[model samples]
Target: MTKDGVDTSGSGQQSGKPALHSVYSVNNILHKVQILDGVKVTYSSWVKLFILYAKGYKVSYHIDGTKPPAGTDPAYAKLCEIDAHVLQWIYGSISDDLLIRILETDSTTYEAWCRLENQFLNNKEARAVALEHEFTYLSLSKYESLDDYCQKLKDITTQLNDIGSTVNDQRLVLQLVRRLPVDYDTVGAYM
Candidate 1:
């Protein structure tokens, strides 16, 4: 046993030759990744984190459009196996209803991932409309502070940008001025 407690007697030899150290392990990667729960608002961030984690393990190609090579090459085969394993983990992570919505035709991990993005994250038109509606209807409650209201508006604008629409800074400033309570008319004019 080495100082780290890994048994070294069987560690080096594989097929009568010394083996190179394997860098990626599913257990290690999975331990750090959070399962997707099928919420559209959080899906983008979740996928980004998962991509970073998988890239650290050199397995990001499984979802990034690179096809696993065909044939009996040991490294290629191992990568393909890992890809399938990672894909299975992804499938297992999402809600059952969402999993069922994944098309039967999506034979690879990349295709399934794209399907989910299209279903949830790619509705730019709908998302923009919804955000516009929310912005139009937003009003500060009597109990809500000006800072809190401004933060809420900022968050909505950020969400709009994330979904491929951008609110101009001038428009946002105007909205803030227009939406203030009547009592703040003097303060609004000073700005």
Candidate 2:
């Protein structure tokens, strides 16, 4: 797998190694990850696999320091095994916030963001922050219950900020939380 620009054959083979030099743009990263032979990846497929891996799927590193997560949901496990190429494409450079935005969106918005992300990518504008802002606002506003909101956000290891809609007048998320407490376990985070 590629790291800071140099290729490292396997994880433990070299204690410290360089891969891709620096992190490429998200679209660039996607393009490189997409061509893995035998892996028919839609934007959603990448997102789903990314999520599963982020959530710590069991897998072994291959000779190239890349391998599919083992015993993934049967459906995805097959995809990962068939296409180890995607796993080789790592995102050591993307920010935690950008990753969180991708994780938080519903599947539909996730797809839309993929398209939008590519547009910026093609333009040579690494606008992950702008894209994430739009995505977070849309995701947070669509919730009917805190549980649903929390479910979408639970895997977000990165914290988000100031994501409320422009139409929203509240100055703090805790205020909004106190006003609508359908699920304390979920709402308590913001409070």
Give lDDT: candidate 2, residue 152: 40
Worst lDDT run of 10 residues, candidate 2, spans 156-165
* Per-model CA lDDT versus the true structure: 0.70, 0.37
Task: Report the C-alpha lDDT of model 1 over 1-191, residue by residue, as the tens digit.
Answer: 55655556865554445454333345444466566653332566667787886677566787889866767766786665666767775676666777888846536778788887776667789988988888766777732699878877777776676677888898888888888889989988987
Output the lDDT of residue 100, model 1: 84
Candidate 1 pairs with clashing backbones: none
Each prediction's TM-score versus the true structure: 0.62, 0.23
Candidate 2 lDDT:
0.37
Residue 109 lDDT, candidate 1, scale 0-100 = 76
In TM-score terms, candidate 1 sits at 0.62
RMSD of each: 6.1, 16.2
